[model samples]
Target chain A: MDVLTTPLTAFSQYFSKSDYVLALPMILLTVFALGILMIDLMLPEEWKRLNALTALIGLGFSAAAVFRIHSLLGPEVSCIPGFFGTVVMDRFAVYFFYLFLVGAAVAVLMSVKYLEIERENHGEYYALILFSVIGMMAMACGYDIIMLFIGLELMALSTYVLVGFLRRDQRSNEAALKYLILGAFSSGIFAYGLSLFYGLTGSTNLGTIAQGLEKRISANPNDPVVIFALLAVSTGLLFKIAAVPFHQWAPDAYEGAPTAITGFMSVAVKSAAWALLLRMFLFGFYPLRALYVPMLIFVALATLTGGNLAAITQTNTKRLLAYSSIAHVGYMLLGLIASDGTSNTTGIKGIMFYLLVYTFMNLGAFAVIASLRRREIIGDDLDDLAGLYKKAPVEAVLMLIFLLSLAGIPPLAGFYGKYFIFLSLVETGHFALAGIAVLYAVVGLYYYLKMANAMFMREETTAEPVKSSPSMSLALAICAIGTIGIGLFPNVFIELVNWSMSGANAATIAQLMH
Target chain B: MMPVATTFFFYFLSIIAVVSAIVVITRKSPVHSALALITTLLSLAGLYLMLYAPFVAAVQIVLYAGGIMVLFLFVIMLVNLEKAQLEERFNKQWQVALIAVLTLGALLIFIFEKGRSVFPQTVTNFPENTNTQVIGLLLYRDYLMPFELASLLLLVAIVGAVVMAKKRV
Candidate 1:
């Protein structure tokens, strides 16, 4: 009895309040998710909307927890390792946590009306959204490979279901199946790579792995195992970001998923992947920067070319945006490639800023499409947008703002996003890459304007005005304000990104610079 | 450098695993294919045992051979087999599959060739009887976060299956 009690006490002592405090946001979300599932079982059909309200409250509370952690940690503490260092409390994680929660909240707001229209309103929908956001938060904060993998799977599995939520639609079924098979395959490759690293380092803790990797690299500067692991891991991550040659699933999945979910996936899911990529490279595998930078350049060039070239012929609105998102991935990758192993934090900061802006603008664009969804019309075709200006003047103007911002026009957040990337590229003296990226940006504008032209110039295809619920309008308004606000006051958002970069990993990045 | 018995058992398990795995894909009958899969799984478990990972081998046997096999057989039995057999066995997509396989094979070979130089590091051996205890401690202590997250992941999987398969939600 004494021995048993001793072990139990020792185990209980291992987890202090700080552990739970750092993980509070994710913990709160999980609780709310479980609560929603339990509540859904008892709630009547008419009251299903309460789940959405519950989810919003959960997000709000989680956000408050994030800010609480921020205030508690203050600006001086770089990061605090929590849960035995499997996760970390850091400004970087806090920043992305806010981004994910905000993206998720707006997604929920946009989803209510869309789900109601599709006659697919259910509590599970909101629960799944919350669950996926939990996964994204984990990805943002995870400090170990195992935690990252589990987090990635959680997010992937939820989205796979969400993508095919419309069970009656055949296209949705096909897209879900495709995404599932491909995503699972990539995850397997990713695990193999991480296992190789574990074998090489004899540890899963990223800090320990970094030390081990440095030793391995110094001993055998050209270790093939390191290259193989890098390639395998990057393949998996690039697939998630929908980069070139691995992006085939994105267009189909985007076209097939519920419009509101498409918004969530494009914004929150992609940003989560970018966060993971930055963490893995800048922290665990920084010693191999010389080996990976060339690889990123080629992939970025191909992604830009393939994504823009492919988008030119797309008639469907969702598929076109999917390609455009792929192109944006290309630009961000260029930012990554421009990261010099010196104290220059511009490249990484550019990616963070770009992702922040992308969340608002892209989700706004998707929300507009979701608003166009009617009972009979699928409302995804470019022709469907004809004379949207006549029917819904306000919505059309908002859509125009989203499109122009996406096209990198001045006075829009998208332009600042591209501007930072270009500035980083030139700062790192990649003038050639900068020139090519600018050319692709011009090409991207063509397709975006194509949609805009149809909206304002063509005749009305349907007599009914675009009907959007108040919640959707709120979502649109949030996105519009965020996109325009960030653009007009770029300095403020830049400061926010700069504050996030001033974390423990910022030290790791600084080490990479020199 | 190695004991003769251990090396022979390693080769024996490898051969069986490869042969059964090949049989799994080549068999025309779904039942036969599933049975071959079980053989493949069991042989892989034996291989794991040879590597001193008894816990993994046990899990492979119980989960893959025992639990999932039952699910596979039940589904196979419920589906109408004769009508499926009469339908097209192969689609025009075989070309794409072939290309993908070739590319993957080429990559594996390339990696294996380059990795040969770094393959001869020391192999750490743990005490045989303490294997389970060590793993349990590591999972519950140092790896607790991932362990709990895995439970949540499985929950998502269950929820996803329900959402995708059920006629109504």
Candidate 2:
């Protein structure tokens, strides 16, 4: 009895009320996910769409909680380290939380009709999305490597299942298999790197690991252990973002998955990886910036060139978007490379802004493809998009907006994503990389115009009208509005990005103690 | 200096682990491969025990050598082994794979050789009797978040497995 009481007291000391408050968003999502699973059993087939509504409600609640936390903490005290620093609720985490919730909510909206068309409508789909949203939230807030890794696995596992959700489709099965195998391989490499870091630093906390890395760097400036660990970790993250050399899995996975899932994967999953990458590099591996920067430049160049070149040949719409998403990763990497060490966070801000904007435009583009799905036709080929304007004028116009934005056409939101990244690059004086990035942008413009040409110019092939469900239209409207709104009125969103970045810099951890 | 018996046993177990791991991959027969994998896992458990992590050793034996091996054997038995044996054992890109493997091996060797000095000669020792207790405390308290999140991971895996394996959802 004495032993049990002593251990219980010690365990109780590890948590507090604030910790639960800090984790309310994840808790709410988990509870909702479980609730959906439980309620799924009693629902009739006609009411299956209710699962999507529940998921959206869960995302809304999570977003409100994040907003409350953000408002309460404000800009001055940005970082709130909880659970003994395993997680942190900072401006960065808050910003990404909203981004992820929006991505998931929009995805849930898109998934309802798409899953029904696929004849795979089930509560598990919405529950899985919520679970993945929780994972993304965790990834955003994870202050410890263990937390980050678990979050990554949770997100990866859910996405893998979602990718293969269409049980009857052979392509879907193939895609999920390729994604699972490659993803598992990369995770192994990632774990190896993490274990090495733990062995070298004797700590899993990012803050402590940064300190340990600094000491190790001073002792041996060119230690191969540190280099190997950096390479391995970056490799794993690169695979997630679909960067070149490790991007072979992307086109297959994207092409094979359900259209809504492909959209979700392109936005939410990629953003979570971006969040993890930024946190790990900016917080834990900042000392090795000099080494990683050069490596990133080469990879970014390859990714840009490879992604654009590959997109030109893809007749399949999903495959084309996959390559384009990889190209977008190149631009984001440029932003990361240009982060001015400890002082200026212009590049980091640029990345956050770009991810936010990309979520809208990219998801909008995919939502259009999802809207085109009918009983007879899958509507994924460039030819399937022929005469979209003649059929569904609103969706066609909306898609035009998304494609133009994606291509970095000025006065559009997509241009601002590129603008911020290029601005950061120039600010840090990476003119060569910036110039190369511009060249790829032109190549990107060509393929995007190709898609637009198919929609507005090509003769109508299929006689069947497009299937634009209400939920899908709402998703498209949200995305289109976000894309146009950000493009036309960039100042407000720019200020938000600035505010998030100011509180998320290297000084964030220092302010945590107070 | 390490005791001769302990060092010898360490090297012996390591050799067995390495050899059996190679055999596990290289074997043509599925049953033989599974048996070799068991040998590898057992040797790894022995090595873990030598490192004074008795709990990890026990888990390795119970989970890998015992439980997973049964699953592996079942899978091997269920699959059409004769037809699998007749199929091409290697893909057409074996040459490319060989080159890639060699390059990776060389890189790893170079890294290990260069970073050898950074590794400490001795590891910090925990009280062997209290190893499990300390780990339990860490898992439940300091690592409470990840521990809880791991349940979510397992749930996702379970759901994913069911979704993939079930005939209909």
The C-alpha lDDT values of all candidates are 0.87, 0.88
Chain B TM-score per candidate, please: 0.79, 0.79
TM-score of 2: 0.87
Instruction: Report the number of clashing residue pairs per model.
Output: 4, 0
| Per-residue lDDT of model 1, residues A134-161, tens digit only | 8888898888899999999999999999
Stretches > 4 Å off in candidate 2: A1-13, A506-514, B1-52, B57-66, B69-116
TM-score for candidate 1: 0.87
Worst 10 residues of 2 chain A by lDDT: A1-10
DockQ of the candidate models in sequence: 0.50, 0.51
CAPRI class assigned to model 2? medium
Query: For candidate 2, what is the DockQ?
Result: 0.51
Query: Candidate 2's residue-wise lDDT over A75-156, tens digit each?
Result: 4465666776788777788889988999999999998898888899889989999999888888999989999999999999
Model 2 error, position A426 (Å): 2.0
**What is the lDDT for B152 in model 1?**
89
> For all the candidates, what are their Cα RMSDs to the real structure?
5.4, 5.3
